[model samples]
Target: MSHAIAADQREHRRLQLAPTIIRADIEQDGKSREGYLINVSLGGAFLSIADPPAKDTTTTDLHMLLPWGIGECHVQARTVWEQTDDQERAIGAGISFIDLSEDASNQLQSYLDRFKELSIEITS
Candidate 1:
């Protein structure tokens, strides 16, 4: 199954990053699980983990360190979708930011914009 979102359906363009290890603390149902951020956009992100929350899970709290010495960003997210490998192992999930403070949003956008500019320079 393809995980690609249709271009017309996406609200924002996703920025693929180099393999950067960003540790994340995901909270749900009064429990917390560790994961890593894979890719991100202004709207959402893909999180990789050994055990993902149930599909029925609606919301989660995520705390993760931003790259480039940007410090940490926190937001409440809604589980939009999930993916599993053939072995039934949990691979990752797509989470949309449901609640983000203005400061946090600005911080994230700045990081993404910097990354975008760097990518353009590298490609050119």
Candidate 2:
């Protein structure tokens, strides 16, 4: 596949996830907590954290469940943006993956492909 397609396949888009479907144990700045993964791609994932969003430029270790029973993926990532509620209360954050492995990339791609197919099926 071309490099561009790889990047697009893992683009950080939003997807509403069922609770406990993909659990994420987030470790950052020496603190450890847990969050549910809202959406995930090769590039990054948007995590719906119950705790307050971390500070800017935070590097996080994301341990999560991949789609379609592909298995769990543990990758390092950095916070790029944040999502807040109407009251500006800290809600969730969008993270960009730092370095990903080839195996992990393929697994993520497969997971994404499954989602794409499911979306089409739902629409059709």
Candidate 3:
């Protein structure tokens, strides 16, 4: 298979998460905004907030709360894109993880794995 096809299939294989309330603290340029996580995959996550940073805003410090009694995880990410509503209000932004500590990566992978397992069980 071609590389493009494989990449597309990998994107499609990401688990679709429900609207779980995961807290997120995003910091950029010495400013911080608290928000809720919308969805997540191993590559990236969508964060819902009242005021997203500028489109070109790249690096950010992200602190996220894990579900199922798991503790928090901190990682650095780059903002890939931003979204807004019809009213021009800031809705959310998509961020790709760029820097993750070994522990944080393991924690996030564990959480994602559990979520995937639960999802499969529900569908089955």
Candidate 4:
């Protein structure tokens, strides 16, 4: 399926963040490892990891290091899907937000809104 179609079918829209290294802390199986946020939305984010865990877990704790002074935002997420490379190696994971606090939700929404506004201005 095309990217646009998938996005349309999703519960919450995703924003393809600019090429910036946004660090993330993915904690699973009582361990914490570093990852990168590939895309983000109100629901969850797609993460890029160099070395993903061999064992797949249902849920994880993610801490996003937002830029522009947005700082770190924490959320509980579940691994809903995965993306593999041509060799059938898991390169990225697609997650769904489980429990989102009101403050974190607001902060994420505001950050996304700013980017959306910028994109609109650039296009128009």
By TM-score: ranked, best first: 1, 3, 4, 2
Q: Candidate 3's error at 8, in angstroms? A: 8.6
Q: List TM-scores for all candidates, in order.
A: 0.77, 0.70, 0.76, 0.73
Which has the higher TM-score value, candidate number 1 or candidate number 2? 1
Query: Runs in model 4 with CA error above 4 Å?
Result: 1-9, 13-21, 53-56, 86-90
Report the number of clashing residue pairs per model: 0, 0, 0, 0
lDDT ranking from best to worst? 3, 1, 4, 2
Regions more than 4 Å wrong, model 2: 1-21, 52-55, 84-90
Residue 63 error, candidate 3, Å = 0.8
lDDT of 1 by residue, 1-124 (tens): 3446566244445344343456899998899889987677667777888777666467888998887888889988876777877476448887777767997888788787888788889899
lDDT score at residue 89, model 3, on the 0-100 scale: 51
Local distance difference test values of all predictions, in order: 0.75, 0.70, 0.76, 0.72
Per-residue lDDT over 1-124 for candidate 3, one digit per residue giving the tens place of the 0 to 100 score: 8999789557735745443557888888998889877667656677778777666566888898898877889988776678877476548887677767888878887887788788889899
Point to the candidate with the largest TM-score. 1
Pairs of residues at least 3 apart in sequence or in different chains that clash in candidate 4: none
lDDT of 2 by residue, 33-103 (tens): 99876566667667778754554665688787775779988888776677777476548887777778887
Task: Give residue 92's error in model 4 in angstroms.
Answer: 1.0
TM for candidate 1 is: 0.77
After superposition, the stretches of candidate 3 with alpha carbons farther than 4 Å from their true spots are 1-19, 87-90
